[model samples]
Target: MSELLAIAGLDCSYGEVQVLHGIGLALAKGEVLCLLGRNGAGKTTTLKAIMGLIPATAGSIRLNGRELTGLPAHEVPKAGVAYVPQGRRLFAEMTVAENIEIGLMARGKGKATRDMVLGLFPRLAERLNQRSGTLSGGEQQMLAMARALCLEPEVLLLDEPTEGLMPSMIEKIRETVSKLRGLGVSTILVEQRVEAVLAVADRVAFIENGRNRETMTAAALRADPAAVKRYVGVG
Candidate 1:
């Protein structure tokens, strides 16, 4: 139960426009830690900082006690972190298999790793030859997640994963997250749905106005649904 990914006093910005201020998070191995806040509350910025996609001007991001603050964005995955951004970014013209192959390139994963991740999303398996851009919204999300899993990451950063998905797709995404937990993959989940947040989060941290607000056990938060709305911006 040791911390696998840790972020302390994180600060991020876009050309001097700071979006995060002293954000901190700790994700233990095999645990799901959710980040809650309103739009533009620095939730996604925290995740990007952790992934090295956005530079952190101040703070520490460590994985397994190893410093990751200055690691290159491309090297972050090799260091055991995989990120699935909110948009499901994939090569529009690439086949599903090709997209996954690109993910495999991060850590030099091969057929076994490819097959394992593909197994997680059988729909993606069925569409291995299909172009990613032509897939449905839900399927694109699946591919994005499967692609990240190809890195066999110790920590997974999921940003609004269930957004715009159907009920069935949302359930599938939740099921996949549960499976990842069983597989000992820690996750930092940024979600919009209160039910989904409760379903997967072992703990929830509130980020407010670009700073660390507080953290609580999911059970504690679930007992107070009104607080859940207030904290996560459910309105």
Candidate 2:
């Protein structure tokens, strides 16, 4: 199958401090690829580069055969990529429904998408009118994800969706992501939760010193946690 998204020889820098180096990735339709690395390993930079949030010093980004390099960040979303950053950035002052409404404001998706996102995360339905800032950590994460889903994106890029949630909430996010895959949404997940990420990912990419150290099937990583630990700073 042709890739939904592809990054080849990607390199990035923060000022003169170089970050990502020769990073490459490909995500097929309905497949989830997880990127694992220790802090400062450039995992987030890879995502930013692909989204055009940060300019790539070198490399190519293609979405479904269209060259995306140098496209403005805003235009990248129009090309069918939706990103949920690490912090679960939500409009704190806005209500849950209002927050999701923000996501569709740019795309002009109608009420049907709202209903779809609500159906996928029923908790958000009950909290529709509630202030998003008051939501617990887990609810906020769901709200963040729900907002992204409202876009009905062809490819989803998630950065640490389970970063600080409790174990139960982590499980909920895991199941939600699994359902997204079942729904045929291709995803690239950058996460710190080793066990949680591996559980849902179809394939794994381990990064070390700003490069792709290895790419293997999820089952292979599960069978050999030690290898991942050595690369990602945890087992």
Candidate 3:
């Protein structure tokens, strides 16, 4: 339960427009932390700032006590942080195998990494040569996560992972996340599906108006439905 990643007094902006204010949270080893909020509540911004996709004007991002703030986006992954963005940003023209290979090559890994991911997602194994653009929505999502996993990251940042998926697909993604947790991969999930995230998260943090409003155990949030409704604006 030692801290794997920590954010404190974080602030970021897109040019003159500030989006995050004094945002802070921490993730323990092998734990899943769900970030909940309404649209434009700075949920995605928080993830991006952690990954150095957006520069932080102030504050600290640390992994195992190493400073990560101000690191370039590419360097962030090298620091053991992998990001699966909101949209499944797979290369449309590339095959499933090709897409997975990109991540492996970036990390100086070879077929062993590819075999590992294919083992986690057997469906992808069957369509290695299939064009990513031709795959269904669920398949695309699976590929995005698989690609990130190929990097063998210490911390995974997922943005709206369940968005636009069917019930069965959502369940599959949920099971995959649970499996990852069991394997001791620490994760920060930014999600709108309250119940889905709550089911997988060890803890939950509510963000509002570009700041962290509250953080509590998932069990606590589930026990207090009123708090969930008040902070998340959803029950």
- Cα lDDT of model 1 by residue, 1-235, tens digit: 5778888888899996988988878889899998889898888988888888899999999899999999998888999999999898899899999999999998998999988997899899899899999999999999999999999999999999999999999999999999999999999999978889888899999888898888899999867767766766564
Could you tell me how far off, in angstroms, the CA of residue 48 lies in candidate 2 after the best superposition? Answer: 1.0
Which candidate wins on TM-score? 3
Candidate 2 C-alpha lDDT tens digits along 116-196: 889989988998899999999999999999888877888888999888889999999899888989888999999887788
What lDDT would each prediction earn against the true structure?
A: 0.90, 0.88, 0.91
lDDT of 3 by residue, 31-125 (tens): 99999888999999998998898999999999999999988889998889999999879998999999999989778877877888899899999
- The alpha-carbon deviation from the true structure for residue 113 of candidate 1, after best TM-score superposition, in angstroms, is 0.6
| C-alpha RMSD values across all candidates | 1.2, 1.1, 0.9
TM-score between candidate 3 and the true structure: 0.98
Off by over 4 Å in 1: none
Q: Residue 13, candidate 2: how far off, in angstroms? A: 0.9
Comparison by lDDT, 1 against 2, better one: 1
Backbone collisions counted per model: 0, 0, 0
Badly placed stretches (over 4 Å) of model 3 are none
RMSD of 2: 1.1
